[model samples]
Target: MAILPEPVTLSLICILVMMCVKILMDQTKKNKYHFPPGPRPLPLIGNMHILDIKRQDYTFMELAKTYGTFFTFHFGRAKAVVLIGYEANQEALVKANYDFGDRAPMPIADDFQKNHGVIFSNGETWKITRRFTLSILRDLGMGKRPIEERIINELQYLNALIGSHNGKPFNEKVFYNATPNITFSILFGRRFDYDNPNYKKMIGIIDDVVKLTGQPEAKYYNVFPIIKYFFKTPGLVVKRVNELNEVLHEMFKEAQEAKTEDSFRTYSEAFLQKQEREKATETTEKIFTEKNLLASTFDLMVGGTETTSSTLKWAILLMMKYPDVQKKVHDEIENVIGLERPPKWEDHKVLPYCLAVMHEVQRFGNILQYLPHSTPTDVSFRGYTIPKGTIVVPLFSSVLYDETKWEDPRGFNPNHFLDANGKFLKRDEFFAFSKGRRVCAGETLARMELFMFFTGMLQKFSFTPPPGVKKEDLDLTADPFFIMRPKRYYVIATPTI
Candidate 1:
């Protein structure tokens, strides 16, 4: 009977051998990978339990204090190495530049077929997109007359919107929509009319999506990838992103029809021409298509809109909290360029306090709190070995609020950017736009937008808290997002005129 069953016995023995091999492989993997020290983790769940979840700020800062500048944390199956403090950030971003240049592959990125736009793409694709984006921006008259002209147009529209209130207490959010829309126009070569219903609805969707992004619920989705199917929040993000894509696609379709092959005029027009030329090449695989053009355009629209607008929103909130500083800034702007005209990008040279105030807003508000980077290969920095594909976050909060870097790290002080004579002075550590190869491509445009739009608003109106409100009582606290935006609060825009 045993001799007759030899084949079945052999099969059973092979199954046991395979199970043993898998166990040995798993154990070897655990032993071979030496991760950086981190807080105690639960089996399978890892350190997610220890994480503050909602407060990435508090969690990261506290982890740095306990585990040193560089520590590791597990996001489900994936491991993330956090780099805290200025020096750690420098090591990852500068010293190990190329090594820590890759972005972690996520489900969203994968769903996009890993064909992420310039901001998230790695290696050659990223290089090509970034280089071309810079060149195109310059060609489209970034840092030139076109930029100033567009800004002035937008400002005139914004001023009209604000002035419609007849010096009454109207919330600035409606008018503030112009700031982002202007940048969107420059990037996509299309502008939204003031009070456009579709535009307002799009903004509302984006607001909700952005709110859900930095929340615990979003973080929960990130941790448990399998559970994403059951979640509504992540689905909402995807839906909003798709809606944004549809909007951009329609804009692109319009640009394509309006495109004259003889004239490569706007960003979209030039990009479409380039796409056509490259598609004619035998190696069509490498050519960036109209899709890439639209995606890149979308990147600029989202990045520029969210960041620049949020910073300015926070600026008004800060001014409300410190009315004395606000008055000084108002007085300085008035003294330099009177209320007859709104502030222009050119007026930045004379408006020292206004310039300083903008810088202070960027520093103090610190939107885009920490710019996350990732290691592409093994790198040794100051004797510590950084393994391949480790997340290298530049603690932007640390750089923005460095105690050694700033005299008043906690305060909203425009003097932070001023000297004894009150001239605007730039700081090397002010990495608001970040630094090196991966620094923000749209920084020049964003800077111009912020200065022009902010000064434009302040020149026309002195923003004050509502009646019976104390400056101290003004809630300057942020709405707690991936971008630090002030909580919704109405202010009286007393006309400076």
Candidate 2:
């Protein structure tokens, strides 16, 4: 046998020693704590070989059959405890929220946000930012009549845009342009015209960032960040993120210049006023910085836009597929609110069938399958000890589709939310906005947007699959993105009014 060079032999010896040390450390950890049982991980890749990166939630559900609700899964060398089903998710997210409230350290988010925003931030930053955000949103009329009027006003623009389609087959992404303006109305104290160039550019950038972040390659980058050195998509995402930041910074500057004393017109203005107060105080810590402002604004904009628009897309798509159900919703709207007057938030209480259909759309859409959380400290959960800082994935999809919770979990049945007498039934298992400390911040706004846009659209238009396309042929397969959205599909919105 040929003798290896001295340097090569030394490098091999070092690598072997490192691997041995890792094995011994893992063995020691296994012996020390009763970790959740899962498939044994191989070196390097861990459970990734068994996981479908694009649909890890589905893979985790399958794994739950063997490992039960909480199980250990590895992403490369990183350890994670996957929480499956409603019980497990509730236990971690609701009952023991404090223990599992920290946002997991996602490499991509860290690279982009650096723990500055509400979504990916933790500890005091999260607390302060979230508190201020909720207050400002409420002050600006989230979940109230002031915001409802804004949504109602925005609906006119949306209706006009959709009506301009003239019942021709048009891609449902047109909703994307209108939905963010609702968010913008609160954030910047204004809404953009649908045809505005800057508005279109901002939406396009957000669209690209969300889609890129959801791609399987993005998941791979999170697991093995070294891949970013070889891959271009991650770099592209950062570039787009920077472009978005530029837009936000410009808006921030505008808000600062346009500020008036003791008066707040928008969320941005509120945050700036708060920042000035923080500056004037004698405290050493600065909680409300420009970085935080930019990040929080980005979080609200993206959060407010993608999920609502995606849910609306699903609502329209599902209605087209199930015209019978759509007709019932239409008849309910006609009987209760009628076409002459647009649907209001108050109408939801009277329009049980319409409300049921809306709930069913959210349940069936399952736009956000999971958002990863982390244990703030070593957590004793469901008889398993998950180490501190371990990533925990509370699979929301599993909760939404839990077999024991719904009568027909797989089918698109609005009856799931309806009683025998057709009254709307509220199920706790509908974990659409999530739960606990990290529940979606814009839940109220999203709820208002969904009710108004959905009912309003149904009031004016009758949606159907494109000409010659059968309802049965309409595909509901979700496009893989950070937000699970219906694949690009066309619809004919015949004006019913």
Candidate 3:
């Protein structure tokens, strides 16, 4: 064998020495800290070897039973706190919001975000962008009439599309893409035809990104980027994110070129106005820049599109499973508003059962079951210390499924939102829209859209499994994805009216 160069041999020896020392120091620190109770971690790999990446929540669920409400889990070399139960989560997320008020750094998410926008950003970036976004939802109309009316109007198109389905089984695509088409019109001041290929492609890309980024392989890539060459996911994800951002930028440019003075036709215009105002200030660290706007707009569009669609899927699924509830909703709509007119947002108060069904859908759906929240500063909570930048996952599923909080947390029961008198009741455990300062900014828009779409569907067609299929045969568990999306099933939308 040939002898290696002296410099190369020396460098390799030095690197090996450093890595050994680093591992030893990490082991020492792990021993020194008063970390929450959990399983012992192996050397170098930490607890990754024991973690069930495909079903992390299940693993967490089992370990929590052993370790109690508060515990720690290691993701490769990194460790994070898992907060279970309503009190543990509420105290950390709401009562001590600022202490746990940052977004965790994921290599994939960071690559897509580049530290821009509200959803994936923290500190001043999040604060300013969120303020700007909330302003659009609060002040004036998204365009023309009020946001609720806009949603109600768009319901006609979805209603027509499903009507065309002729009661056959249709995938979530129509239901999923409907909200995005409406929001895109609101954002870009234009609408895509139902068969518009570009719009379809964009929506499909976002769907893939959402699901792929949440997979166990994603964690592996984050922990080991060198594995990227061996696997295709990282590269493909990056390409798709670029494609999405490029499309958003183009749409924004088109909107900006067509100047309008009539009170902000689209969200893009409103965001541009903010960007211009901030740009004229000429100060560094001005959060309202083009990249931020693009990221924010993209974030809003993706979020606005995906969430309600997922919730509505669960809604229809539940309705099909419980024909009694579906009939009750139809009866409630006919009694309260009648088939002459669609369900309006104001009619929500009187249609208590309808509203209850909607709430139960969201609460039980709990699509955002797993989330990563970060501590921007060293957080000392409940006699434990969580260092700055530590990733904390406040289990929304825990709150939604807490037996102490819900009468029947596991079942698909709408009575959870109804009282003895059959009136709608609100529960504090309903954190489906999330809670605290970091709650979903699009809560208003999402709620209106869901209420209208859900009621509208039930009003036009009664949902059920295909002929000869029983409710018990339907699967309740979601497809393994970022969102708790229900598995593929056939639904017949028989004309109820």
Q: Which candidate number has the best TM-score?
A: 2
What's each prediction's TM-score? 0.90, 0.94, 0.90
User: Which regions of candidate 2 are displaced past 4 Å?
Assistant: 1-30
Weakest 10 consecutive residues of candidate 2 by summed lDDT: 29-38
Count backbone overlaps in model 2.
0
What would the per-residue lDDT of candidate 1 be over residues 1-497, giving only the tens digit for each residue?
A: 45555898989999999999999999976565666788877777877877766656667777887888788877666678877766777766777668777866655433432564677677777788888888988888887888888888888888778777775666647545776676666656767886677677667766766686776667677667776788776777777777777776776777788888787567777777777778788984673875577567656766777888888888888887887888887788878888777677788888888899999999888887665677788766655666788766667877777777789987888999989998889887788888766788888888898888888888887887788777778776667665678777777777777
lDDT of 2 by residue, 359-476 (tens): 9999998988798999898888777777888888999999999998888888899999989998989988989999999999999889889989999989999999887999989998
Candidate 2, residue 31: the lDDT equals 71
Q: Weakest 10 consecutive residues, lDDT, candidate 3? A: 136-145
Worst 10 residues of 1 by lDDT: 107-116
Better of 2 and 3 by lDDT: 2
| TM-score head-to-head 1 vs 2, winner | 2
Question: lDDT, candidate 1, residue 321?
Answer: 82
Please provide, for model 3 over 418-449, each residue's C-alpha lDDT reduced to its tens digit, 9 standing for 90 to 100.
99999888888888877787798888778778
**Cand. 2 Cα-lDDT:** 0.89
lDDT of 1: 0.75
Residue 345, candidate 2: how far off, in angstroms?
A: 0.6
